[model samples]
Target: MLCEREKYDKISEESNRKTGDDMKIIVSGAKGQLGYDVIKRLEALGIQAVGVDLPELDITDADAVGAFVSREKPDGFIHCAAYTAVDAAETEKELCSSVNEKGTLNVARACQKNACKLIYISTDYVFSGEGEEEFETDSPKAPCNHYGASKLAGEIAASENCDKCFIVRISWVFGVNGKNFVRTMLRLSETKDELTVVCDQVGSPTYTEDLAVLLCDMIKTEKYGVYHATNEGLCTWAEFAAEIMRLAGRKTKIIPVASSEYKTVAVRPLNSRMSKKSLDENGFSRLPAWQDALERYLGILNEC
Candidate 1:
């Protein structure tokens, strides 16, 4: 369910008490799904979160970013902005590079200039998905798609520029305020009788709200390292879609498809699942299972 602003604040406050500090956080791409969750979570914790997106601030503009960071001087900056259209990115390489690479560079540089901690959100696409085991934090990044390559470039820029930076890689993120697999299925189910989702790609379907909480927790802990964030369990696209339909009480048949059959502009990893061992080793709490989170989401959708 979409949490009301006040309710979200209360939860954030609880999270802040655990973290022990209500920090001033700057969130770029505040209009996007992940950014929206971040902003709401920050407000809940009684933290001051300055949201900058589009007209107010574009990460691509170096001067504007520097000026804003200078003025806000936030305790931490959560760089959530990115060029996220995976298929489209294959053709719009330059545009993708401009935002995902150069734009990230601008944000990272600004944060360094302000001496603020940075939490740069990245994707699991950095891995080539050759093995069955989950990808480690330090695994060599070998992107198979342009989108992943651009994000990896951003990660490189951020790591080089910021001293206290946490490059978090998450997979299959879905949320209330953005376009995602769940939303697409729900929308399509209303018209079509069945849906074909690729089952070969295995990974966690992370809920943005849960991820927002984790991000706040990580920032408060002062853990300056790379980490993976996703729900506790994993599943393929077909399995995930089936669960979504079942929860929503929709009788849409989900047909399983192979990666090759569902041909797109960009190539996807067969196994984008990431290991949460880093977070576990670091002593943070584990998020609820993906199935549990999906049930909660369905409850919210039913209310609407």
Candidate 2:
């Protein structure tokens, strides 16, 4: 599958249909939060997208990645796998680096060799907690936590390796398929009378479904390069929890807290909101605000 980039570019340029049998896409980290949603959307689009996750494919194994891509020979590769345990990274730095950093290098090398257009899922953790403005695509990375550093490293590796790559950086993602902040709040609201959430940290809360739809569109359009894909608008964790409670029709009391109030091994950026300039400039539209996405997600959760 490691063909010349020029060859694949020529072939891709000839293909105009975005969501049809004309494209062969592979989604790595298929079991994770974002990966699961990506696969679902791909199916809905009538695209023959295959998923490779744990037990099926371990990205850290370079030989495994190469063999899988070689056998599949997919036209596009969406990498959602990463070491995402933020606090755990304090002790598992080696593991995080191996997966998020070195593992990304391995995948990029394979994609570069195969000439597959790579779409990598990154995080807002790359920025320092210094600004209140939304982070631009060109912002310098200054990760404050081990998890962030590891993910940033992965982004760098992938960008340097492949010319036709999409680095989608998102923040505070929630979905029906995985462990997330919203689910945590919902669960805690059930057990606790009142919750004290950090109000100082600000960022957008993204719904995986919205992101999935955007990803599908991007792949179809062959829109490559770094982009910030998340639900529009921003709020603090406390406000986000309040919105979740309101949407779920729950009466869980939410109390505000500062970053210092809740100490963790990793320091979260005070400002994690990202600019959607790149997405707009690339001909893709911004996702709906967080509240709208949450209502839809809650509606689905209720159905499930």
Against the true structure, candidate 2 reaches a TM-score of: 0.93
Give per-residue lDDT, candidate 2, residue 240. Answer: 96
* Candidate number with greatest lDDT: 1
Model 1 worst lDDT run, 10 consecutive residues:
1-10
The TM-score measured for candidate 1 stands at 0.94
TM-score of each: 0.94, 0.93
Q: Taking the tens digit of each residue's C-alpha lDDT, what string does model 1 give over 98-162? A: 99999999998999999899999999999997788878988888999999999999999999999
| Model 1 alpha-carbon drift over 4 Å, by segment | 1-15
Task: Report the lDDT of model 2 for residue 176.
Answer: 82
Question: Which candidate ranks first by TM-score, i.e. highest?
Answer: 1
Residue lDDT tens for model 2, 1-304? 5323233233333442533557788998888888999999788767888998888788899999888888888888889988899999999999999999888888888888888889889999999868777789888889999999999999999999977789999999998889999889999989887999999999998899888877877776667789998888889999999998988878889999998999978888999978898877876767777887888888888898
